[model samples]
Target chain A: MNARGRIPGIRNQHQVLFYALSTCIWCKRTREFLEANNIAFDFVYVDLLSGTEREAVVEQVRRWNPSVSFPTLVIDGCRAIIGYRPEEIQEALGL
Target chain B: MSEIPREKVEALYQRLYEEAEASGYHLNPDKEFTLGLVESLLINEARYGYWACPCRLATGEKQKDLDIICPCDYRDADLLEWGACYCGLYVSEEVLRGERPLQSIPERRPPEGQRPQEQPARAPAVSVTELPLPVWRCRVCGYLCAREQPPAVCPICKAKRDRFERFL
Candidate 1:
């Protein structure tokens, strides 16, 4: 999905994006697999955001995952699938 | 093969700053070093290719232990060790082989006034089924046994095969 629409009910409006460290092979593989499966997603480079820009994303991750890890998939709204497990991602997004 | 581009650096810096703000913490410059290291690893991989994952340490000794004779630091008993990655994910042959039970390492540092010891806790009644067959782990450095137990010599550190232990 394009990065234009907002998640209904969320105060700050921004489309869900895949938050990832750009150079990780697992991250790349996850992205490629998602794309290959025709799963629409926008990538947010965690390495490219400013201090204030990533505030919400980080909070959401902490609230879900036990740790701050790369290749975290934030979908629809607050739901997150941390790390790159193809099976988990498939099940999460219903791919 | 080339220096990190200004754009990449700026983007990385901005992202780290955002993460710090989001996480309610400051970013450490050492993170830049870690990023650089990973970047270089990626570049090298792209240029050359995938290499078999090399064992870092054999038994309890460094790889260089092969060059000199030794009392054979390798273990002949059952023991378990745990280590974690910067991302707080556990890294161990045990986990890779699916021998480890599900557990999460805490991300936050312990509160002030209490310093936890460095030892990692072991799982209860560790299933021997989960341990990999000791084909190549060094007795000296605890490196994974890639092939036959204790190769004629640890190709990584040159420790003789006699130094390896059977964890399986």
Candidate 2:
């Protein structure tokens, strides 16, 4: 829905809203990969946040894939790639 | 009583003691380590023998040795199905009299706010103000577990499901 008579790209510009635990090795690795690639992304620390905040996150994850897992990678507005594998992520995002 | 030297057990006990101390736990290193060795030996014994004793000891309602409970029980129950008690004289009496094999340590705490199981999300309707407040959508699949009601176990993949980047 746009003046251009075409669907607009998602307004959300960030590559990911990475959810992770501080002690979890994989979550840390995912964050490192995003930083190294210079991809600006949102990060949610599930351990530190309150119950309500956590609930919000769960709702979001469910929307993307019924089978969503952690270290979810959100692309554009509607696509999600779960877990962290740089090459797999790149391929999925066509980066 | 077997061929395993007492020195080996002592060394292991010493290392375990150091770890406990470093972790800020006040424990009698020799005693705790010996108990640990005994527990391991008992596990081996269970595999080979037909005898199995209760995993924990309790007096009336109080319990002890929360650590040895299976992780499954920790995550599945509402009340901690296990924890340690500190009734000093009673504990000493029991131990000295050989009535209690495992001594009570302090209760092992879970990470803050971590319940055994994720509470079932309530279907309470969000207010209009809350409406369109923000819903995090996953990028992997179009799963929506819900916000303002964080799903403990993601209904989809059972991830510690949480918010995603919001669209609006």
Best by DockQ: 1
A1-95: candidate 2 lDDT, tens digit per residue: 01011112232244555654332334445667666666666666543444676667667766874433445667766577665567766665555
Task: For candidate 2, write residues B71-122 as lDDT tens digits.
Answer: 1122212112211122111122233345544332322334323422223433
Taken over the whole model, the C-alpha lDDT of each candidate is 0.43, 0.40
- Candidate 2 TM-score for chain A: 0.70
Candidate 2 residue-wise lDDT at B148: 60
Q: Model 1, B108-129: lDDT tens per residue?
A: 3322232121223233344655
| RMSD, one per candidate, in order | 16.7, 24.0
RMSD, model 2, all Cα superposed?
24.0
- Report lDDT (Cα) of residue B161, candidate 1: 62
